[model samples]
Target: MSPYTRPSIAPQVFVDADGQVIDYGHRWSDSPPTEAYSVTVHPERYAPLHAVAAALIDHLRLTYDVEVDEGAHVVADLLVAPSWDVPRAVRVRPRDPKCAALTFVFTAFPGVIVHAGLLHDFPYPLCGCDACDTTWQREADELEEHVFAVVSGNYSESVERRDGEPAAWYQVRFANGSSGGSSSISTVAPERLEAAAVTLPDLPSGWRPWPLRHAAEA
Candidate 1:
């Protein structure tokens, strides 16, 4: 939890000085958490985000047939692209991987990408300074905001992917008449992105896809 040390888990996921999403790994090394982590020092040791994720999953099970991996509920990056590593990508195996589920990105904004076609490009600076620490809290708030946005349907979001060059011009638009995106020059290029959309029957099961949805909503 020290600003100088890597938190095994923060309130939510965020990228590190390196461009990888912080997860329950060996902490100092690049290795993922071993099986012992789930029992002894699980990453959700940061209880706030864990509780939030758990609550959403509990809510979903009330109406749907939800199945989760034995220890699927862990603190990890919501896999978008290899380069779009802004953490807060929490996941619980509610469905088959990337078949018909959406992705939730709580980095630049609370974006619930309905499909992989919508690329999310954000800043992944190599700096690990106090200034970035301050920025971290502000950006990390997106997770809570995303939950609120999805549950209440009160979010204004836009997805923009980098284009043209590494950090140069980025072309932005939407399937409908969408707007709002980042124009910062300090961004890593987006690699491939692919995720599943939660398959929802058209019976209006009291729930449907929103422009931005949490992983639980899937």
Candidate 2:
């Protein structure tokens, strides 16, 4: 039997602007892939979150033929410390066209860390404030409430690797309208998340967690 229980912060149903958790994320897969993710935002920033997520998903598929899994919740940020050594939290934002999205930013990390300051736009003609600050506080609060709950239950799983290399990874398969073999996935990356950017060849339809293609194989 698997030696783990449900994550306390297990990606719960996405709470909308009205604080209602929607039953959209999560699905059944024949292969039972590993890893799951979601996109969330404060009750007020729902429209912005969805808008940016759509752009990001389209950018991924166009740049790479791979499909993103939509089973994970869509939140405003993935609240994590800027680094293991730092206590200050960082927010990861989705892409948006109406606002000047910060594709990436250099941080105080050892090297040039690409801060997914996706919502770090400033003087928004509409919001009249910096996007990053507004979303950061709300998203960070949400993440703080859930990260420990989820990580406490995060565990490794055995899966068939591309070859017989015995790689450690997980998948969040999609039984929904996804066009790929899997749903959302989280694995080691060749580059850091913020620093990694895929140039799109064509316009995209919506946003979903982009797959980690080069994750270590099992």
Candidate 3:
């Protein structure tokens, strides 16, 4: 939790005529293998990131017999000031301390190294507009939503995954007994959503588990 008061203003999005975005800043990870969920966010996003960390733990508790790390703040903003030193990153831990960490790097990319197998680097392009933000947010939203779905097998009435196959992927059997699967799953993806969340790999790029094709409100 971020107890420190923060500035009302946030880092503004700037895209030059060439379609390149301004380099706000960069963060370097010692590349530590901390068995936790960590997100490298801009200073402005500290609060929301903190909330998400707690929510993940809560979600896990519902479906699985879970044990979270002993801590007051599961999601912590490294810093959240308004001046020279602001939040460079946020961290979330929702499982056993012995498990591998899942690191999300949502920041500038220069001089950053993400060699750790568990870490994911989301570098903001040098030239981008508001669209980039929307895309990134959408990606984050999809990740969280699908992760929970796959973990709880809640995307459909019942689910079964065939991950041991050459092209690893999961299949969803809807309440109507109709099932669908990924068109192409390059390499081997995680068999369980819990593994997927921790590794956060590039596979299973299009799970398409949203907008409710099974049933829509409208």
lDDT of each: 0.31, 0.26, 0.31
Query: Model 2 misses residue 131 by how many Å?
Result: 14
- The TM-score, computed over Cα atoms with residue i paired to residue i, of candidate 1 is 0.30
List of clashing residue pairs for candidate 3 = 20-127, 21-126, 21-127, 79-87
TM-score of each: 0.30, 0.19, 0.30
Ranking by TM-score: 1, 3, 2
User: 1 or 2, which is superior by lDDT?
Assistant: 1
User: Per-residue CA lDDT of candidate 2, range 33-144, in tens?
Assistant: 3332122233333223322333333443343324233311322133222331321222232233211111211122211111222211111111212222234234333322
Please give the distance, in angstroms, between residue 141's alpha carbon in candidate 1 and its true position after superposition. 4.6
Rate residue 87 of model 1 by lDDT. 44
Location of the lowest summed lDDT over 10 successive residues in candidate 3:
110-119
Q: Candidate 3, residues 24-85: lDDT per residue as tens digits? A: 32211333234312423333432343334335444443434333343223212111111222
Global Cα lDDT for candidate 2: 0.26
Kindly list the per-residue Cα lDDT of model 1 for residues 82-114, writing each as its tens digit.
333244543323243222222333232212221
How many clashing residue pairs, candidate 3? 4
